[model samples]
Target chain A: MTRVRIDLFASLDGYASTTGGTSDNPMGEDWGRLTAAYAATRTFHERVLGDTSGTGTTGIDDSYVAAHFDGIGAEIMGAAMFGLHAFPDDPDWKGWWGDRPPFGTPVYVLTHTAPRPPIPMQGGTTFHFRNTAVEDVLAEATEAAGGLDVRVGGGVSTARAFLRAGLVDHLHVMIAPILLGRGTRLWDDLRGLDLTHKVTTEVAESGTIHVTFTR
Target chain B: MTRVRIDLFASLDGYASTTGGTSDNPMGEDWGRLTAAYAATRTFHERVLGDTSGTGTTGIDDSYVAAHFDGIGAEIMGAAMFGLHAFPDDPDWKGWWGDRPPFGTPVYVLTHTAPRPPIPMQGGTTFHFRNTAVEDVLAEATEAAGGLDVRVGGGVSTARAFLRAGLVDHLHVMIAPILLGRGTRLWDDLRGLDLTHKVTTEVAESGTIHVTFTR
Candidate 1:
C-alpha cells in the first residue's frame, strides 16, 4: 500500500510563507528566518544545498529532515511551487531548482493549462505536468511510485486541497517560532479534522514543534 | 509592574470550541476529550470542578494548570463566555460558575449592552459589565489588579481583540490533540505575532503541547 504524505514548514501562526514573494525573492522576507532550523540541518545542507563538506547541525532537526526523503518515491506539487507564475509567458521555464534537481523521483506538477512534454533532469528526476483532479493526480502519482510512498509537496493551497479531499495519509508540520503575520494559512477550513486523524506532537530543542497527524 | 496574560485551551487546528454549544454542553460535543489533559490536573479538579479530594494527575499538566491561577488578580472575558447568550433577557443571570466562582478577583465582561451593576460572588469574584474599548477595559482591569497580573479569559474573539490591540504581555496556549474542524480559530489575523513575543514549547506526556509566548 502506497501512502500519501505531506511535509511542510510553517510559522507558529500557521502561515507557510509571507505574501508577495516574487520568483527573485522566492520564499518572501521571513522565509530564511522561518526555515532557519531546517536549513541548519545536515540533511538539508547535503540534499538541498549540495554541500558535501558535512556542515550543518546533526541533532533532532537533521533527523527529521533526513526522514523527509527516506521513503519518497513520487511527488505532487502545485504550479505555483514550480515558479510558473514568475514565467507564465515564458514557455521555456523549468523550475527554481537548477538543472540538477534534488528529487530523484517522478515529480508531477498540477496546473490548469495544458502540460508540456515531461522534462528529464539529472539524478533521475523527471517533471510531468498534469491538468486533472486531485484524486486522478494521486492515482497517477501512486502508479508511478512503484510501491514506494508519494509525497505531497506544497504551497499551502495545494496541500489544503488534498487535505480537504481527504486523500492525505500522513501529515507532518514543522512549526517554527516565527510569525509571518500575513501569508497563506495551512489550518483554514480544516474544522473537525481531528475526528478523522490522530495527532501527536514533539517539541525539538530548536523551539520547533513537530506535529504529526496520522490516520 | 503588572503583566497582562491570556491562557486558552485550543485544538491542534487552533479552535477554542465548536459552535452551538449550549450551557449544558459548555464546550461542545468534543469538549471533554479536548480538555481531558487539563481536566486531569489537580488544579482543574480543585479550582474549577470544586473537588475537595486530591484526585488528579500531578505532573507537567498539573504544573501548567496550577500556573493558570497563580499571580492573577483580575480577569477580562467576553459576554459569550459568561453564558449571557443563554440567558440574555434574564436580569438575575450570574454566570455558569455557581456560588463560589474560580476567579477570586474582579472580572470585566466586554459587551455592547447597557452597563450592569457589579455582582459579587462568594469567592471574591465580582462580575462587572462594561461597553468600552480594549484599552479602557485593560486600564480598568489593571487598576483592579493592584500590581498583580490580569488574566484574559477567552472565547477566542476576546483574546484576539486584546492580541490585535497589542495589549497582551504573556500568552499561554495549550494545544490539545483534538481537532474541532469548525469553530472560532485563535490564530486568525495574527500573522507576525512571533516577532513581538518569544515563543517556547513543551510537549507533555499526555500529548498536549504547551506553547507560551512571552515578551
Candidate 2:
C-alpha cells in the first residue's frame, strides 16, 4: 500500500508560517529563523539549497531531512506552495525552486485556477495542477506513486485538509522553538486526532521536537 | 520568587476537556482515557483519589503526577472546574472533591458571580472565590503561597487567561494519545507563545509526551 505522509516545520504555537508573505518574501521574516535547523542540515543544503559541497550538520535533524526524500515517489501540495500566489496573473512562473526543484517526483498542486500544462523540470520532477477534492487527488497521487509512498508537501492548509479527511498515514511535524504571533495553524479543527493515530516524540539537538503521528 | 505553574492533561489536538461536563463527569466522555496515565499514578491515587493503600504505577507518569504538587502553595482555577457550572443555582455546592480535598493550599476560583465565603476543606485546601483580574488574583495567590510556588490550576480558560496575560512562569502539558473532537481548546489565540518561553519535551512510558515551557 502506498502510504500518505506529511512533513512540516511548525512553531511551538502551531504556526507553519506567518501570514502576509509576498512574492519578495514568500515565508515572511520568520521563515528563515523558523527553518534555521532544517536549512542547516546536509540533506537540505544539498537538495533545497542546491549546495553540492555537502558541508552541513549530519545529526538527527539531517537524518530527518534525508528521510523526507527516502521513499517518496510522488508529492501533493497546495498552489501557494508551488509559488502560484507570487505569479497568479503570470503563466511563466516555474516556482521558487529555479529549474531543478528538490522533489524528483510527480508533484500535484491543488488549485482552483484553470489547469495548466504539466511543467517537467530537470530530474524526474513534474508539476501537475489540479482543482479536485482531497480524496480524488490522493488517489491520483497514490497511483502516480507506483507502489511507493506519497508525500503531502504542505503550506499548512493542504495538510490540514488531508488530515481532517483522515487520509494521512504518517505525519512528521518538527516543532521549532520559535513563535510567530499569527499565521496558518496546523492544529485547527484537528480535535480528537490523537484517537486515530499513535504519536511519538523525538527531540533534536537544535531544540526542535519532532512529533510523529502514525495512523 | 514564587513561580506560577500549570499542569494540564491535554489531547493530541490540544483540548483539555470536552464541553458540557457535569459534576459526575467533569472531563466528559473521553476524560478517563485522557487521564488514565495520571490517574494510575500513586500520587493521583493518594491525592486526588484518596487511595491510601500506596498502590499504583510509579514511573515517569507518576513522577509528573507527583511533581504537580511539589512546590505549589496556592492554586488558581476557574468556576467550572470547581463544579460551579453543575450547580449554578445551588449555593451549598462545594466542588466534587468531597469534604477532604487533595489540595493543601489556598485555591482561588475566578468567577463573575456573587462572592461566597471561603470554604475550608481538610488537608489545608480552602476554596476562595475571587471576581478579579488574572494579575490581581495572582498577586493574592502569590501572597497566600508564602514564598512557595503558586499553581495555575486550569479548566482550560483559566490557564489560557493566565498564559495570555503572561502571568504563568511554567507550564507542563501532558499530551495524551487520545483525541476529543469537540471541547475547550487550550491553545486558542495563544500565538507567539514560544518566543516568551523555552520548551522541552519528555516522553512517558504510557506514550504521553510531557511538553514543558519555562519562561
Candidate 3:
C-alpha cells in the first residue's frame, strides 16, 4: 500500500517564517534559522543545491534529510509554495525552482486558479495544476506514483490542509532550537493529533528535535 | 556566583494549561498531560509525591527530573502558583502543598501583598512574601540561597516575568507532545532569546521535548 508522507520545518515556538523578510528575502531570516540544521546536511547539499562536494555533516540531521528523498513516487504542494502568487498573471512563470528543480517526480500544485498547461522541466519533473479537493488530487497523485509513496511536499499551509484532512500517513517535523516569538503559530488548531498517529521524538546532533508521527 | 534556573512545562503548541479547568483543577487536564513524562520519573516519586515504590522509568526524562532536584538552593514563584488567588482574604491559606513542600530551601512568593509574616513549614521550607521588583526579589533569593542556584518555580506568568527581565541564567522547558488546540501561546514576545543564550533540544522517551536556553 502506498503511503502519504510529509516533512516540515518549524522553530521552537512553532513558527513557519515570520521574521519579517524584505521583498527579496520573502521567507525572512527566521526561515534560514529554522532550516539551518537541515541546510547544513550533506543530503541537502547534494540533493537540493546540487553541491557534490559531499562536505556537509552526515549526522542525524543528514539521515532525515536523506530519507526525505527516499522512495517518493509523486509530490503534492500548494500554489503559494510554487510561487504562483508572485506571478499570478504570468503564465511564463516556471516556479522558484530553476530549470532543473530538485523534485524529479511529477508534482501536483493545488491552486484555486484554473488548471494550467502542464510545465515539464528539464528533469523528469512535470508540474500539474489541480483545483480539486485534496482527496481527488491525492487519488490522482497516488495513481501517478504507480506504487511508491506520495509525499506532501509543503509550504506549511498546504501541508496543514492535507494534515487537517487526515491524508498524511507519516509526518516528520524538525523543530530547530530557535524562537521567532511571532503571532503566526504552526501547531494551532491541530488538537489530539497524537491520538490518531503514533508520535515519536528524536534529537539530532545539531540540536534539532525530530518529531515523527506514523500511522 | 549564584545562577538563576527555571523549568517550565508547555504543550507542543506552547500552551501551559488552558484546557478549561475547575476551581480544584486550576491548571486543567493539560497540566497533567504536559507533565506526565516528568511525573513518570522515579525522581518525581522519591522527591515530590514521596512514593518510594521504586517504580518509574529512568530515561532521558528522568535525568532532567533528577537534575531539577539537585543544587537548587532557593525557589521563587508567583502568588498564583502559591494558590493565593484561591483564598485572597483568608490569612490561613497554607498553600496547595499539604504539609511538607518539596522545596527544602526558602521560597520567595512575588506578590503585591506586603510581606506576610514568614510561614516556616516542615522540611526546612519557609514561605516569604515579597513586594518588590524582580531584580530585588532575585537578589534577596540569591543571597538567601547563599551563593547556590536560585530556581524560579513557575506559574507561566511568573517565570515569563523573570525571563523577560533577563534574570534567568538557565531556562529548561519541557514541550509535551499533546496539542490543546487553544489560543494561549507560550513563546510569544521572547524574540532574539537564542542570540544571547545557548539553546539545546532533546527528545524524551515519552515524546516530550526538552529545550534548554543557557547563558
DockQ of each: 0.59, 0.42, 0.82
Name the runs in model 1 displaced over 4 angstroms: none
Q: What 10-residue stretch in candidate 3 chain A is worst by lDDT?
A: A14-23
Better of 1 and 2 by lDDT: 1
Tell how far residue B59 is off in model 2, in angstroms.
Answer: 2.8
Tens digit of per-residue lDDT, candidate 1, span B140-185: 9999999999999987899999999999899998888666666777
Cα-based lDDT at residue B41, candidate 2: 88
TM-score result, candidate 2: 0.90
Candidate 1 lDDT, A148-192, residue by residue in tens: 999999878999999999999898888886666677778877766
Chain A TM-scores, all candidates? 0.96, 0.95, 0.96
lDDT of candidate 2 over B55-159, digit per residue (tens): 998988899888887988899999888864877667789987788877888999887774988899988899999999899999999999999999988878889
Whole-structure CA lDDT of model 2: 0.83
- After superposing candidate 3 on the true structure, give the runs of residues whose Cα lies further than 4 Å from its correct spot: none
Q: Considering TM-score, where higher is better, how would the candidates rank from best to worst?
A: 3, 1, 2
DockQ-based ranking: 3, 1, 2
- Model 3 local distance difference test score: 0.86
Give Cα distance to truth, residue A88, candidate 1, Å.
Answer: 3.0
Candidate 3 lDDT tens digits, B65-178: 898888988999999888638886667887988689999999999878756888899998999989999899998999999988999998788888888988889999988887
Q: What is the TM-score of chain B alone in each candidate?
A: 0.96, 0.94, 0.96
What level of docking quality does candidate 3 show?
high
